[model samples]
Target: MKSPIRIILLILGFIMLLSEGFMGLPFLGGTYILSLGWAPLGSNITMYFVMFLITILDRSNESRSSLSTIAAVDIFANMIAFIPFVGMFLHWLMFFLMLVYIGIVLNTREYRGNTTHYDRHRAGETVREYK
Candidate 1:
């Protein structure tokens, strides 16, 4: 769970999407060899971990809107996944969203002795005026 966390989430989301297709199919006792019995739980765990990572890693420079968008995606995916046939659309949309999340994560620049957008936003306003 380091910088590679984003990659891990991407892979997990993709695998979960695929598993949702046939993992529950009735092959052996209504289950397949590649079946993931608790796939939704896995997805939830992975997504929450991602939220945790974002909360801890992001600098003030990072866009709050993007973070909120990631949370929104997680919420929407989880909610829609329980539906019947419509859930399939959510799965595909989620795969695309995973890519979007990765892009946002990759675009977020770390604060390394550099001023951030947040800093610039407050540049004109300060608690104390110059003496």
Candidate 2:
């Protein structure tokens, strides 16, 4: 996504988080009653939104592929959390996957090389270049 759009979404997500917290506040110590449960779901969506932003913003080949893979799996898993009787398990799985994603992001390197497919005519030259 464009920087402008990403900025807008980031701002919106922050607002959503703050408002969700405010809405979940309870009066006179009835904290348990203030559980709206929507905040978590909204935050999940916002996380995915951020993922989408990353996918478009980053130009590195390896990074883009990794982010896209994680985002696809995560968003689907989050959606699967709506399934009957398995919602909690699915959510936990998704959360675990999120940690794995973070690790990948932290360690992945930006691949910098000529990405053009090798042609028969250039095969001889390509071998000398990399070797």
Candidate 1 matches the true fold with a TM-score of 0.50
lDDT against true structure, model 1? 0.53
lDDT tens digits by residue: candidate 2, 37-69: 434555566677676666756665355676567
TM-score versus the correct structure, for each prediction: 0.50, 0.50
lDDT of each: 0.53, 0.53
Clashing pairs in 2: none
Model 2 TM-score is: 0.50
Q: Candidate 1: which stretches are off by over 4 Å?
A: 1-42, 49-53, 114-131
